[model samples]
Target: MTELDEPASAGPAVQLALRELGILLDKRVWAPGSRLPGERALAGQLGVSRSSLRQALAMLESEGRVHASAQRGWYVTTSVVSEPPSILKSFTDNARERGLVPTGRVLHRRVRPAAYEESRRLRIAPAAEVLEIARVRGLDTVPVCFETTVLVRARAAGLESVDLTDRSLFATLEEVAGVRVLRSAYSAHADAADAEAARLLGIPVGSPVLVGEEITSDQEDTPVLLCRSVYRGDAYRFEATLHRSPD
Candidate 1:
């Protein structure tokens, strides 16, 4: 059957359950190895019959979305795509959109003279003051990444006192600094997690991780923030849509 015709064949309850499961995975509400709610509870929550729920879960399991543990119940196998390429969103926004809670813990925040690299990236005078923050970011109760972000001090006015534990840097910048992130130039690569990153993410030292770096710009194309993030490879998935060039 064609892709479009497949959904029509699924019973309404199965279809709804599939959709809900997709959202939960997408938002990282259930991290890898997380146990799903019991069958009766889950069926009640989804307003579906036990048989329908089992069928829907079977489909997902076949697709690697979840797995059943003998007698222990179902669990998510991995994290789904957290962000879509066409839209730029903050970590908090991405999580919330997918039915998960986003949280951050500031490990360190300081205003110091910009280093050579920071100055170069932000296109500011050397030795200029800059605000740098290091944070451990998570979805629900799962530790997923650790990030270090830098911003030119002048562009981050009033940000020194903003509470970041339950907020996003992108949101705070827009609200307090009136800067909008129009776009970002980013790159990512696979790497082994270092001691600190491993500790923060509750992974073993030298575990595989995705390392990403980005330079974000405002609506006017002015560089605003520089960020380096390390994500736990097993608990996160990256997704992007590809478009063919027009002839």
Candidate 2:
């Protein structure tokens, strides 16, 4: 009989199951963001009771290694992608620096007249033409962020025709439009995923997410692009270095 078959005490059974589950996760027996086996099958394979397996899974969940859905069973958590806020880098650059394959899928693209809010954000006249693009971004096939970007159409002539799939917007701007983004003003907050964000990021509606907004500027400090992003809370981390101000 296996050690977990029928332990004299529940504690040992739980510990054994936890160890087994940890090993599986460490070895990537299940890939990140992939659903785990059902509790019954997993419990039987580990020779532990469902209750014991549940306790182990709970422990893993607390450690950010797994997550559970109300009706969809358990899933392996995606690896956290960390970015330092002090540096300015494109998503593609950051992912490549971490040895992850970056990917993008453009969801929506159009040229439209800028509304009051859009013009205010982009520093353009109301009703001016602007290019709007929405995309889903991922690393290693795990969707992590949904983003929307808008810019004055005149800044990037023919930009609407560029195929942005698997391409970096920063690179495209430099190569196709001779526009270089030099800096940005950014802010973020904790928010619940809305229906649209949930659908794009593949998370349940109301799941915790990090929402960010940025205004990018050219060398002359002219606001050239406005971007908004929603990032999965479980899959992304923003790091910053804090320092005390001089007296």
Candidate 3:
């Protein structure tokens, strides 16, 4: 029998660790509406910071795992997948807090001249330098997205300076590199997953995918990330709250 490679852990520490309590409850560690242990107690049992512990609890609350009574604390919310998308406020932290393993492996990270297409979109000088990063991202060991990102290297110098793994793309840009993403335009299309995508996505060749292209800009209106992401349609659902005035 072939052994699969062990997946990456969320790393050491309680607040940031893989507090599987969320998934555990999903897998029936506790029934619906069951009251979980208290925060201080759970922090003690898990050997983590109260903040980290609270993060997990917050995720559970978001998913309906626990509810809060004024004087009391949170209790169970639901049994099925109540976890929300990472796009809410701090999606990355929320997803991690809920025990949904998020991993990004660099397929290629390099510095290259901007492509003609990029030059046209970013309005940069032809042959301008840009940072290119491609990653195969997974959710709980399931490959679900292929992210190919490009950025203008001049406006934001220090290309290839920080660790891409173990960090959020936008966070690293905003915090370490001082390149805060301010605006973005995204467009999605229906396409088939290629062999490389299939290998990463655990699906048959030519599987359906939502090809999303996004161009993110800084507060100064300089382009930050020109990203092309192929997300597994089976693994993702885009949601929104559309308010319509009653006719």
Candidate 4:
């Protein structure tokens, strides 16, 4: 029988199809998170029976190389970007370490009076002027995080006028304001995407997301910035090394 007529149980046929699909993915014929063609089309294109194609797809799913969506067909899983909890690194630095291009789009920027909570977080008096900056952060043009940062205006003077698009905020702070981020206290939790977050991250509303909050301090241990970030759950991973306590 021809390859297209091979049964699903034919191991060779499924393996061949799996290899072909892997090559396509490596070449990025379809970008991360993009839906593949229908099973029938994919089967025909790969010169395999529908059953064999399904078997190959199942293998890929098991490997976390792709995922099936209810009613939406199979999608290429996004390349996961990971950061260790003990390391404090900028998004740009993390992406570059993984050979991905980091990008950002400034969504909003202004000087505003600090709210009560913001004042407390920054250890500044209430109503103190604060510079607020919001951005959509991405890897290779794929949106991954939405972030907002607030800092006392005096700590980062002239920062509001800096062009942040496709740039690192941490780097800019050091360069322009000479305000180095020496340390940060951070926390994260699971969340669902809201409408604005969905639009910015290019995901459906109610999709899984990771919400993170951080307060960063400078050399003197003075809080300099408070930030909140929402990350696409599918595209990001947080990792930490653990040790057993002494008995």
Candidate 5:
């Protein structure tokens, strides 16, 4: 019987096959569209069961290669493809799409006198009533950022009754509360992590961190989300494309 027709097996053989595959990938041992040797062929060559080879390929598919179709056998990826990062497709959408899980422990959310910075960010009088929300957000169970969000209390009345934990705040505002977030302008800088930011992000105090501030508005251009977020430097990477002018 051929390798394709061979019986399945498990364990150390499975692991070895996978290890060899990894080395091959690192070396590009198989070019794009290269058909791996038939299962029986590989199993015999690797001294493993055909079943084990199949299991190894299954794992590869999960890693974004080795596409399998109904009638066609597995094939190496012919295109440059990567897991699209999680996106905010809608307020109700999941952050996990971009490989980030949106989880937060809410620290504070109440109408209080605005801080001097909050007053300017939210365009309210100094000490004017505003909602101050502090949270430590996680990605894949790892703390990646700490946020202190301030909003115009008068503009977002009834927030005292809203539960803002372990869920997307932007979703709650737009979808559940009927408020809108049109666009936000962001400014980012590098800073040394303070104790609070360090503790929340599981980093050492004085470590490099990313400080980002944004002011969001509504369809009518009324500013809405005014918040600052400090992201851990080691765990976060933000990429963007830009056009440069000729010298």
Candidate 6:
């Protein structure tokens, strides 16, 4: 009689190493944000060759179990998906929705004249006054994004006096100035963190990041805010639901 067929699998040696690596990850031997050991050391510890170890790591990365940072090394990517809100909301609100305690550190804030690029994006005249603010936003101790925003000063009056570190920008705007954000149009790109971005995010220089440039508008579609931000790539994933209409 023919025997029952067994499931096809990876080569025995590679499978053994993959199993061991999976065990380490499942046991939480490495905490999130902690960098993994070098390939040589990890391979030696796991009784595998460097190539085999790399194969296993690649598999983990595809599964969202690990992340490789540029010029640095591999780290455990946070399981949390970093998709933004469907409706207009502030960073504080976004973090809370993901079960994180949000915090912001104001880096700079001042009145600045809009440059040509800023003016075009915000639909304002060149050299118009604007309130510029830069901040580093985080969840607990993990710094995620460095954001800079430019607001039309005439629409954001008294904003300089707001305690930004503890307040929600959206809430403050609506409450203080009676201005509401209707929506934002933005684009995202893959990028490497520069020196300043790396310092603020606590990552090595040249680490991967997602740069977002956005223009926010009010109920009447008048542009009110211009924002540029770099989010840590390892800690966030962007997802969207898409549909195609009948052809």
Q: What is the Å distance of residue 188 in model 4 from its true position?
A: 1.0
Q: List the candidates' TM-scores in order.
A: 0.70, 0.84, 0.61, 0.91, 0.59, 0.75
Among all candidates shown, the one with the greatest TM-score: 4
Model 3: per-residue Cα lDDT over 1-247, one tens digit each: 1112212222344334335665666586654434567766766666665566666666656654565544456555432212243242222454477677676777888998998989878879888989898887765555667889898877666658777774578877787679878677766788988888877766567757778788888878877779988876555545545578999
Candidate 6 ranges beyond 4 A from true positions:
1-31, 37-65, 68-72, 79-81, 84-86, 243-247
Give me the candidate number with maximum lDDT.
Answer: 4
Rank by lDDT (best first): 4, 2, 1, 6, 5, 3
Ranking by TM-score: 4, 2, 6, 1, 3, 5
RMSD (CA, angstroms), candidate 5: 12.3
Model 6: per-residue Cα lDDT over 66-154, one tens digit each: 87766677887653536654555677777888887787899999998999998998888999999999999877657888999999999
Clashing pairs in 3: 15-52, 64-77, 64-78, 65-76, 65-77, 66-75, 67-74, 67-75, 86-91
What C-alpha lDDT values do all the predictions have? 0.82, 0.88, 0.66, 0.90, 0.68, 0.80
RMSD of each: 8.8, 3.2, 14.9, 2.2, 12.3, 6.2
Candidate 4 lDDT over 1-247, as tens digits, reads 8755666798877887899999999999998877899998998898888889899999999999998877778888886777766888899999998898999999999998999999998999999999999999998988999999998899998798989999988899999989889898988899999999999998889888999899999888989999999998888888776789999
Q: Taking the tens digit of each residue's C-alpha lDDT, what string does model 2 give over 7-77?
A: 44589889989999999999999988778999989999988888889989999999999999778799999
Off by over 4 Å in 2: 1-23, 26-29, 38-40, 50-64, 67-73
Give the distance in Å from residue 204's predicted Cα in candidate 1 to where it truly belongs.
1.3
Error of 6 at 4 (Å): 36
- What candidate 4 gets wrong by more than 4 Å, as runs, is 1-6, 243-247
Position 161, candidate 4: lDDT: 91
TM-score of 1: 0.70
Off by over 4 Å in 1: 1-78
